[model samples]
Target: MKKITWLLLLVLLTATIHLPAQRKADRKTLENLQAHITYLASDKLEGRRTGSPGEELAAGYIAGQMKQAGLAPKGDNGYLQTFTVWEGRETGEASQLTINDASFAAGEQFVPLPFSAEKPAKGDVLPAVKEPDNIWLIDVQDMELNPHAPATDKYLEKAKEAAENHASGVIFFNGKEDIGAVRQWLREKPAPLSIPAVWVNRDVSRKLDGDNASGFRISMQVAFQQGKRTGTNVIGYIDNGAPNTIILGAHYDHLGYGEDHNSLAKGEKAIHNGADDNASGTAALLELGRMLKNGRFKNNNFILAAFSGEELGLFGSKYFTAHAPVDLERVNFMINMDMVGRLDAAKGLQVGGIGTSPSWTPLLRESAEDMQMHFDSSGVGPSDHTSFYRQQIPVLFLFTGTHADYHKPTDDADKINYDGELSVIKLVYRLIEKANKQDKLMFLPTKETQVSSARFTVTLGIMPDYTYSKGGVRVDGISDGKPAQKAGLAAGDVIMQLGKQPVSNLETYMQALAAFKKGDKTTVTVQRGTQQQTFNIQF
Candidate 1:
């Protein structure tokens, strides 16, 4: 048995010595890349939105392709790793409101607020008045609200103030103008309150306008149902019976109808077919999987991954890293391709994470024949590769740079440069083959991507969950010796207030950080579960 194992290794090593030329980068490969991108970026796929049916179709296609390519399933469930995108909340159709013996529909005439408590309420609705345990009718004559203190002006805050006034329920309506904008925000998923709340439309508002002094009997039920969707990551493995494994990954998800507010397109809604944004990378991944399936490079195993929910803050990759299919220690390094379709000889192909390992530059320089390559030292960037880098694994991220079509409906499949993308896939294959004979790549940490984007001198040293849609930024990580860590900030702490400014999202957090200079002191307020805690800290 020992002799047989050594002989097999010798055969594999001998094949390495012979250095069989990798599959030729030719017309067939370019055609294959074009076909994959065209299908993935088609209108039928609906831009491959994460957790949507369109994304499910793309996942199935990729899985089938992997099966046909003869790669074994390395995921938890047959070449697919599924994870929850979000557990949002929405008002059920059963929710209704009635006043003065008149019925109002749940969606058309009236709608329940997202944060409202799901409870039935029966009481007399009085206009412009607040009393103990009775519904108060607020006339939609725009209340003079402080712009700077929007937290106090929001519906949730007003509901809390009404609770303090001992109101059983609150009903809002517009008397002076249309409340269409107000009704548009009737979404669930926020933190619910103890009292039920509903907003009445123009028709209902006109009926309730006569009763400044008269009392109207009200009956209401606000039912909120949880909404969830599962996002799948397609994984394919080439088992060479080697010790360490190499990961080549790209995210396949893109904006569908620009619903997430990340789209740069304005006007009427249209599908943000991210052909160059991600279909390019995903197609490249498929081609690379096929290229490596042959018994050419056998020193290390390979995992080809097409991630989902990348546009939604790298959720798919993060989940994959947390619940890795193989022992993380056996992983060699990760190579990520994203938006690599628009390569220009003049601008060059951008190659980041060069500083992740000492051998990366030398290997990259040796591998390049006539390709124009650009480099960055940071191992962390705005891509799926950043997830592996965070796990202490060396990583490389490839891109062709952003264009006018970025994050917009104009980014259609026809706009993709198939030849440029084929070159990228070929480059990734060469890199992997070059490192097949060497030992596992050594990992070295470098400055994060935000260092170049967010320019602030003061350090809070907290990692906020950029994907968090809930009210304020939630702490996902805390760095040692930073202001937040020293001030008792912990992971899961939702930062509500930063000094004098309110920290809402990543943008607001950066804005709040801009006010403070080095050595400045301020108070930071965070929501720790049911409790809101404040801490004093120095920059």
Candidate 2:
């Protein structure tokens, strides 16, 4: 009885005493993460929009934080690695419209379309047709172009027909009441389109004779310029007396003031605080950096990089990989954190790039212990990790998952699940520790999985699971009220055939979707387990 009591006491002591130390460390880490997110996602930062003053503020704050945390400045400049991007926008004065004899004011009576060229254009206005040699005009006063669904069926059809027929450009006739919406929409598309395009109000439209529309000469001058905006990537290098380098990165940029085209909300403009989108990831990176500063590692020096311009494109990461502060060849592995704020502990965290190295799967599994996790074998994903992965370096991407507030103005700091995110960060920290102790991770090229960033004329509104390495595209998510959802397409449905085309991969799927137009009826075949089901989709 005495021996049994002693054994029970020892077991209880191990559970109570030994684990509290880890818990205390984790609590401090969580606090650090929260502090970072609070500042980065704050409204004063104005959504951390790339190229904006807000983004510069964020970069400055990050650098200061890193300095305070005792991180060695690894950036070309002191805690700042600068890169330039071709940022262009419509200059208010140069963007003007003159239809017939009436001159229209910019951003009011008339505004250039998102796809319009910056150069001056004067051409005869004609009705849209199969092949329009002159500028095509489309009147959308009677059509329903909702704020959410701005690209109506008729609008898309017209655009597609014009593009297909090799039309020079298009002019849309929107009423004066919709000027604000039009401006909001145009602001989203910062770059020029295939051909020059413009939008004029009905007041200007009234000036044109319906019978002799070809008689009207529309003169438009939309000016845009490419200038360099300087931003920094806050980098910290930890010297562990090891020759091998391991990089950990996260993009700190977000869509500022819903000005960028990526924002989902329309009409009313607000600051798109990208808390979960990336501030979360940036926070995780900071916390990891702080821990690693004092943590023990047998081998591998660490590079903690907080990148900018990820919202613009993968510009920051791409530049970093190209102009690597450290040798790229010696990089043992890379870990990227993006959108890790809203972790659902039950559904488990997702770890991508498992197939980037042969040892990744086993290493992740061994380090994860009983933590709930979904392992994805793809190296290519929409994050900073892909940049390193492309350079033949092993990578692991941590994502908490997408939410309704993704890329929207409503994605604020208050929505972050701190405890859940802390759990995810802890898991990643453990994995990194394990990786550093092991032999240099061998980089393995994963099978080419086509990621669908394709622009399509029509879509069934299904989010394809790019990580699924299968013969057919798997429908991981069905967008609500979309054609696929209305057609009885559910999540987990593996799309085998779209129309008559065999949907072999994401590329083929895009081709099939592009072949369709709105209101066109097509049969979609999906393999749900052993059964093949056919459903009709009206796009």
Candidate 3:
């Protein structure tokens, strides 16, 4: 009896000691998640803008983390999926026009609109004719100086009408006072046409008012180019001998300069350190990769990808979908992590893409129930998952939601909710485990889908695949918008036909667009829920 009692006591002690260690291990995982967030969100990365050296540095750091996590190279030559982009610039050269004998300099008198294939007018000589429908050349100063100066909207309206009427180009004479402002505006706004638009100083316009001014004419030219600049995507994978793959992605790029609204700072100043914007997401992906690599959960193949150039309009994700390392069809599902570090502790977590796949709701529901996690289940919206959704792949996007500091310089690492992020990571792991145990891949239909963007429009929200050779856009998701809400278009509706045209692709859809202007209505037909439907859209 004494020996048996001693053995029992030993077992009790072991249980007591092991319980705390298990808790400690869980705590350490959470700590590591926070550490990764802090380092990646630091200012040292300089925002990780596309094509910048800072971005390269961030990529290198991420690749190192993946390597340390025991992930194998799933990208070209080790870890980078490279591509190119076209960068644009402006040439500061004055364009002048001579109408009859009247001549104008660049900023002093006129501006040219873009998409003008050639200069519309050239040479000298002509007289004023006030025919109601006849084209007439007039100076900018002449219009501005008039007692009843028309509003800008009115001017554009008249211009559009004039263009429709095939009127000759307008000659704008620059006033000395507003010359600087005019030049600045012209430099920023794309020209309306290649029509012979010219800028002449007040003195020059006055000089041309002399006798024999009939020698007036107009001339102009523009110079530009399209070239390639290199960019890259980092991909890492862990194979668990599963038939289907699970993809986790995040874009590692931010706006390079403070020009657009998405820029982190005001004015043309400050480095856009996109810490919470995405470094947070990328960091989470790294940590998740580490956990999966070390954990005993075995089954589905895991692909972790850090994409470049998302700021320039989801370019990286789009590229990845088009040229995937693995068979895209074999991808069981995709989970996109963007801006996950800044969870609003007060509100808990707001999860999107819950309705994207039938499996998403059930899987997430089970995990949340088991863990008692605080989660809000909204549907998918903008971000990289739209690209995969276009390919008919099921996707779930993870985000903490937008904040006051979003896209601002204040969005630094210090502001992240490390504890909240820990909770989210734990939840994600549970969901992955649940997904891997499923009997078969879930193939959800594209109908009545929900999207956060589009101002809650009840129409089929289909994101077009720009890379598709077919003219019309490849449908990504049909949001629970009007037509889609009523007719039922889900997350994988591919629009192949609209009205009478064979929208065999996106290009054809554009060609069909030329048939209708804003306010004009048309019937749009699309393939969704494995059925064809024609819906009328009033644009």
Candidate 4:
């Protein structure tokens, strides 16, 4: 019986195995890239929004492509690395606001701000004063009084001032003439602020400042529901019998129905078909996978990844790094392709994170024959590559620069430059082959991408490296004509202290920034190498 079982197992294994000659790769061509982008950016997918059905559909398509390319599944479940995402929700119908003896209806007399804290809290309704725990009234007349000054700037200034004064909440008084504007704002989603705020109509505002008002208790019940969404990151691998591994990634998600505010074509509601934004990158990734599967590369394994939720703050890539299928220590480097569809033969390509590895420049130069290449040393940028960079892995980000159709409904498949994308794919393929033949690329630390949700009325106009994880926030880039530049602060300066607060990371820096109002002067201490430099900045 044992001999018979062994014989049966051997027969099954032999039957399943295919000869090398029998395994063939499909031809990689411009037509393939065009077809992939056309389907991904089609109107039927509804913009492939993160946490939406459209994104799930895109993920499924990518997994199918990888399977067809003879690539093994490298994800936790087959070819999908599924995860959850929490999104902001609309106000519930039971939510209401009551001030003084009269009860005001929501969406009529008043509406809560987007970033307002949601909780059941009651406090004494005091007049608009420059003190804590008071519902400050900001008249809309004062906000829009100067049309030339810009209403948004003025409102932000006033809000910042009120926040600095420790006002618990703000009640924007929308007069009869400006009620329409308030209504529009109520419909729009606002970023969550440090404090709760609301918009009250003229009738409600009159009651707050009326002579009959005695003691008042302001009550608000705003609740937010925590939701879980399942998203996938299509992952596959090309085994080359090498210890070192290389990662090639692209995101497949985009804004859905213009809800994320990334849409360039505002006002009119339409599908934000992200053909150039990411479908182009994804197509390049697919084509590369097909090319690599042909066994043309010399050494080093390859990881082909199509990530979802990049539009929603790089959630998919971040999740993959945390739960990677392969050992991160063996990774040679990461190459990311994002927005590579609209490459102009004359304009060339903008390659960021070139400074990440010392070998990248020489390798790129050696491979370039008729390509125009521009490079940036900063390893930190807005893309999936940043996730790998944050993990202390060297990365290269390829982009063709932004266009008028970026993040807009007009970003359709028909607008993609197929030949341009094909050229980029070919260049990358050659670079990969070169990299595979060499030793594992050295990983070097570069400036990190500073990202935060904290709001500020004033800025130092300097970009901080959030992934530094050191004692101080390192300045990576400084905007010209900004306060930091005027104060003589330069990149590579580590901010040890902001005003009186010790800066540790991006969050602490934001907290320190909130302490200073516009026009306030403070001393900034920066660690420039072994020396601690101090400069006075006015914000």
Candidate 5:
């Protein structure tokens, strides 16, 4: 009895000591997360939009943070992995629209559409007449061309109609009421039209087609230059001279002013400060980099990567995996954190890619005891992890579930659940800790997630390279046993056409997919390098 009292006291003392230490560690993690998210989601970063100056600033800051964490630069350019992204089209300085002798500004008054022909066009223009060998001027006054409630479907219809009517060129002019702003380029891939299509502003419209004016001979030079921006990925590594490396990643890019039109905001472009959307995950990634860089694991080297253009469809990750500095065969596995900030006790955290490896189920169960977790087996997702999984590397994506402010300007740093995020980060560290004890886990292919970026009834069983802005839906990876794979279409093949519909970009591809049912049979056309191939697909 005398010995038992002292033993109980010692046990109590040890428990008390550890409780405070745990709390202190948690406090530190929360503070660090807040600090990172506050700056990243601040207005100064301008939403950390991919390919913008804001992105560059965020990348530099992250790289600086990595350097502070004692991580050696492992990227192509120090800590920055740069990839080129197509930023739509910009009107050339020399491009102009001239109606007879009246000339107008290239981008201001008359803007050529993305598919507009780049050749000089000279023809007679009459607003009321549709004749062969004439540049037809169509009055969009009564048309459903409300720039606010943007409907560009009519533009293609008009272009097709004008082409069938044998018009040399097509000029669209607005009537009495202003039609908002005329954006020259559509963000997504647009099919090239046979004839030139130009939209003249309301001011230019009245000058060319006044109520009293007859027909006039028009000569116009249409030239558009492709816009490009360097997309950056921040990479830091802990080289322990291990046989394999473990990759931890998160995407740091958010929509800037909703310019790409992926925002849920009703009207007027606002800076989409994606704090919960990804600032949370990125902050967690930075903290992990700091915690794990000490080489305590002793099993595998660590690669901490913050990717950009994930919101634009995993652009940075695809490029990074394609041009990895290390051997792809030696990559152990990848862990991706997308939106792990908004963790709610009631809502819980989402843990995906459990099925990618047999090791995940037991280990995730061991690590996920602190909170409610929804586990998914498939490695493919809507985030950067899919890029790794597509390369046949094991992957996991941690998410805190989406909120009302998702993809909106309202997703600010003030809304992040700091304590909850800390818990999530701890859980991830625990998972990695457990992983470090074992040898490099074997990779296993899992079933593809039905939750596609394109929410259509049918699937082509292909992952689209969202950043491929050139033309068509570029196939990044073909799903196993899917229509694309079964049809002999492989990765890097550009889906130029699906059935009778022409697939230009993701939007067109989705639209074309939506038109078909599961049992429908169609001819799939793909651009494979220099040669074009067509295959029969039943989907």
Candidate 6:
């Protein structure tokens, strides 16, 4: 009897010892994950723009981490999912335009828009004439005028009709306005038309009128060539023998060159350290990938995808979904991390896309309940998940909200809330584990794109918040087919007003946009440049 008691005691003690060691291992795994995040989000990587050396270095580092975690490379020949992209200015070759004997150089005076799909323009210049004759004119009064006004189908129909009637050239007059906005407008893909088009700045317009060069024969040639530059998407996976997979993705690219505000200042223009713009999210994915691999969760196969060209309008994600390595039908869900390192503990974290999947709310709720963490949830908004949502995959997007240091040079590692981020990762780990164990997730769609139950309501066509700005919502890109785009909103156009209400930031904009209905027609005011203009859009 004494020997039997001793055996039972030994078994209990052994079990007790193993339990604490398992807990210790979990904690250690989380710590190592955080350490990885600190390094990736560091300024050393220089923002990891896709196709750049910094981005390559970052990708190599992630592949190494995956290897170390025992996750196999599911990408082409080990780590890269290579593809091609267009490089250089929008115009392919040297382009020149002569107006009334005055010549304008390509890039300096004008260049092709990024969206144009036509061959480069190269031919002899033609004479200019007034309307009712053989010429059509688009008068750009000032920065306040909406250049998209003429790009609409209605305007294109009119322009096409005029072209068929034998119009010579469409001359755009600045009418005392700065040429920057006009230049941006003209740079967009031109609608298919036979008539040639040209734009003149206020100063140039003055020269044309003063010199009486309007009717002078203009002869010029515009040559263009589209270069084929290669790009890549880094992908890694951990298999658990399940047909369904959970994907954690983030764009690993930022605006290259000195174009966007995030670009480094003149002399320092070589690298735009997108620490918060995306290195934060990319770093978070790296850390999470490592944690999941080490923890050895057996719920489902996991896919870690670091996309390229997000700054170029979610191009990477779009490409990945269109040409997926794995079956899209087997992707159970996606949890996307964009800017998770800048959490404000006091305000907690804001999560979107909760309504996209019915299982998300309950799973997140239970995980938070057990972990005792604070977080807020929204049904839907904008992010890469929109890509998968269109494919019928449920998604959840994690964000730390926006701040003043968002896209600026100030969004460095020091500003990151490491402790808050640690909590978020823990919550994510738990959520992933729970999701893997569930039979399947339920699909839920937001009745309205904008959730009206939030503290404030504003409507801005569910554009993804991309600017790394500190406070107010900084939109990186607008949705292609959302209400905002239908209203003529572009990627860089900042929302200053919604309907009659003034929206100083994203919160206010959301509140205002939510007040309207799907079919509601409202006037929206946006700041395109130095001026604000209103447009009537039917929602």
Over the stretch 1-539, how does candidate 2's per-residue lDDT look in tens digits?
Answer: 99999999999999999798988997888788888898999999999877788888999988887887788999998888988764433335777677778787886777666556666656765554423566676666655665633352355556556766776666777544466556544433333456666767777776652665656677777764333466668888888879899888999999987654678876678998899989999998888888888888749898999998887667788789889999999899999999999988688888889989998888887788767889888787677887787788999989989899988888988999999888777787888888877888999876434344446667687756544434577885565678888999987899889998777656467767877777899999999989999998898
Mind giving the per-residue lDDT tens digits that candidate 1 earns over 1-539? 99999999999998876665333446768888888888998999888888888999999999998998899998889999999875344557779888877898876678777568889888876566678788877665655554454322466767887877888888877733233333434422355678888877788887787645477888999986554578899999999899999999999999987766678887777988899989999889888888899649999988999999899888899999999988888899999999998888788899999989998998898777789998999876678887888788989999999899999988888888777777777778778888997999998977554442346778788766745766678886676577888899998999988988866566567768877888899999999999999999999
Q: How do the predictions measure up, each by TM-score?
A: 0.80, 0.68, 0.67, 0.66, 0.87, 0.63
In candidate 3, what are the lDDT values of residues 364-443, reduced to their tens digit?
87777433434333334557876777677877777787878777777777787777777777778888989888854565
Q: Name model 5 segments beyond 4 Å from true.
A: 1-11, 87-90, 98-109, 121-135, 142-169, 175-195, 202-219, 452-455, 480-482, 485-488, 528-533
Please say which candidate is ahead in TM-score: 2 or 4: 2
**lDDT of residue 344 for candidate 5:** 88
Local distance difference test scores for all models: 0.81, 0.77, 0.63, 0.77, 0.84, 0.62
Listing every candidate in turn, what is its Cα RMSD in Å to the true structure after a full C-alpha superposition? 7.3, 10.2, 8.2, 11.3, 3.8, 10.0
**Number of the candidate with higher TM-score, 2 or 6:** 2
Per-residue lDDT of 347 in model 4: 90
lDDT of 5: 0.84
Which lDDT tens digits does candidate 4 get at residues 285-385? 99898888975774788899999878866778878888988899899899999999998888999998887899899889977779999988878777888
Better of 1 and 5 by lDDT: 5
lDDT of 5 by residue, 48-88 (tens): 88888899889998999999999989898999999987756
Off by over 4 Å in 3: 1-35, 85-112, 118-220, 227-230, 260-269, 369-380, 446-481, 484-539
Candidate 4 residue 306 C-alpha distance from true site, Å: 1.3
The top-ranked prediction according to TM-score is 5
Residue 533 miss distance in model 5 (angstroms): 4.1
Candidate 1 residue spans exceeding 4 A from truth: 1-25, 87-95, 98-115, 123-134, 139-141, 145-166, 174-194, 199-218, 223-227, 451-459, 466-497, 500-520, 525-539
Q: In candidate 6, how many Å is residue 70 off?
A: 2.3
Model 2 regions more than 4 Å off = 1-20, 87-224, 227-230, 452-513, 516-539
